[model samples]
Target chain A: MPGKALVITSGKGGVGKTTTTANLGLGLALRGHKVALVDADTGLRNLDVVMGLENRIVYDLVDVIEGNCRLAQALIRDKRTRNLVLLPTAQSKEKDAVKPEQMKELVKQLKDEFDYILIDSPAGIEHGFRNAVAGADEAIIVTTPEVAAVRDADRIIGLLEASGLYDPSLIINRVRPDMVRRGDMMDIDDIIEILAIPLLGVVPDDEGIIISTNRGEPVVLNGRCRSGEAFNNIVRRLEGEEVPFLDMRGDGLLEKLKRLVGLR
Target chain B: MWEFLSRLFGRENEASKVAAKERLRLVLVHDRTTVSPCLLETLKEELLDVISKYMEIDQAGFEVNIEQGDDSMALVANIPIKEMKRALSRTKN
Candidate 1:
């Protein structure tokens, strides 16, 4: 049976689209699903670096599309998870290197082999964004609690609906529960009200995410940190399992005192 | 003491969050509709011209805005007409 293809996109940059793709792909793979993470952000590819598979890339998505390499040849297996693979993007090529129809064909080819194909879209609503979502069955939009990110997410959701990918789920990344509790930052409810999409998961602002990214290990692999557990829950939700959202509020009296002092 | 301080700070934050939500609500309505400020101005001007031909409209009282709903947006126009010139023409004939 063909697999489900989902595109991870954010119209704004640096809202954790690539990170979400890397972690979600690994999370699904760990749950015994064959997953492939495609770096659709050509010329600005960083999914390879995030996945720690930067050194193993001999052929990229463009290469496969241009007929320079077979589709199977471009897929690099993860160092830890054999079920997970990455179809990297070309660092030297432009976004136009792959057309929408070509992307559709590539995704169709991969659908037969992998249980889930997750595409990491480039920022902006241009050719790159178009290519990223060309073949997606569904979409998962990542955004922060900031107004700018949520605004861009709204535009992306509109674009997705216009393109016939309606009802795209949302992942509110980098949520500061402490700030939300104090009404300083936008809470999950605020974001959902604006985006008007079903919630997938909410990842807390965790230092462990930065460390995990630097180490080329997705936080899901450790599954100890708050962000890691969030990713795990997202995976379960994606698999049609009903998992309650994690309580991201700060714990203990000391934390409350620090929040009171405006220390975060 | 901590509760008191937090409540004091919390009031300011609550006001800001309300402001933020209001701002975002208005902005997202425009964004989803792809209605730029310039576009809205043009639309209002064109609507005024078209409506003025049919009646003597109160230009100062005229308003055109996008109103967002739960699942849709509407281009609402509140054109306050001062008098119906077309009615006068019909009566004169």
Candidate 2:
């Protein structure tokens, strides 16, 4: 397959776009393909910290875009993985510092050398969001199970559809099976009923993500998180493998059968 | 059952189905009809206005909202239907 660029975005904040980017980068890289993750959230950057390369970012996205540094000079090689790289955004620059064209050219430069160029977009329909998805061949819209999150995800989907980027897919994150069962929280069925994008993966709520993120290590490096496995499955699916979506909700087989039969 | 299963055996199609359904339900209700929650509030006021011409009514005891779908919002206004003259007589002294 040809090299692909994917921008992971959400219209609302705190829906784990950074975490998804880091994990997808790790998951794709671990499969032995060269992957570069770019932070398009220019001013408020965190992809470096999530990928654990915060202290090492001497040159950043702004530097590369503004000719302050060469493309290779701004690339921060991940410490643990040879296949993974991070193009950290310059923390001090405004969202308008880098034009959408500049970001597209940078990704074009990286696309030939990398298997997947994942852009971590800021939360909103503003300049940062536009610049992030400008060069992409695909996108993964991360959203939670909340109504507000789902509503914002719809807006992002609408924006993507309007942009003519049909490569956009959905990843419903932080789903609580208990709340879903009690009908208190929205289920994957409920979310899909609303957003209407092609589903990529479903990541269950896991505490390991917080600890790993704080330490500048993504949960992908940890083995216990099923969410990490789910991300890996997404990567495999991206690689053209047919993998069944494992029901992590531990849904009763009988319950599913009953739903299939249209019985309450 | 077999026909339906055969139709949706693949991964890509089903995911799109779920996404499409959700977007349709929320946006149509929110943006399409102009019958949003705010409009429902105004409708409540209008209903009160129409009824107050004939009788004395309790404003706080009523509630109005869109239900089921954006097009078919239910207006269930609970009124005591107090007699205007009888209620006014108690204050006439």
Highest-lDDT candidate? 1
Interface RMSD of 1: 1.1
> Model 2, A1-264: lDDT tens per residue?
557999999999999999999998998898899999999998999888888898898899999888998999889899889999999998888999999898889999999889899999999999998998899988899998876777788778778876668757899889766555544456787677556677888888867788888888878777656666777788888888987775745558797697578673
Task: Compare the candidates by DockQ and give the number of the best one.
Answer: 1
Clashing pairs in 2: A192-B18, A193-B21, A193-B22, A194-B22, A194-B23, A196-B19, A196-B20, A197-B19
Give lDDT for model 2: 0.81
Question: Residue A76 of candidate 1: its Cα lDDT?
Answer: 100
Docking class of 2: incorrect
Model 1 error, position B79 (Å): 12
Candidate 2: stretches off by over 4 Å: A251-264, B1-28, B32-93
Writing each residue's lDDT as its tens digit, candidate 1 over A125-219 gives: 99999999999999999999888899999889888988899999999999988887777788888888767799999999889999999999999
All models, DockQ values? 0.52, 0.04
Residue B12's lDDT in candidate 1: 69
lDDT score for candidate 1 against the true structure: 0.90
Best by TM-score: 1
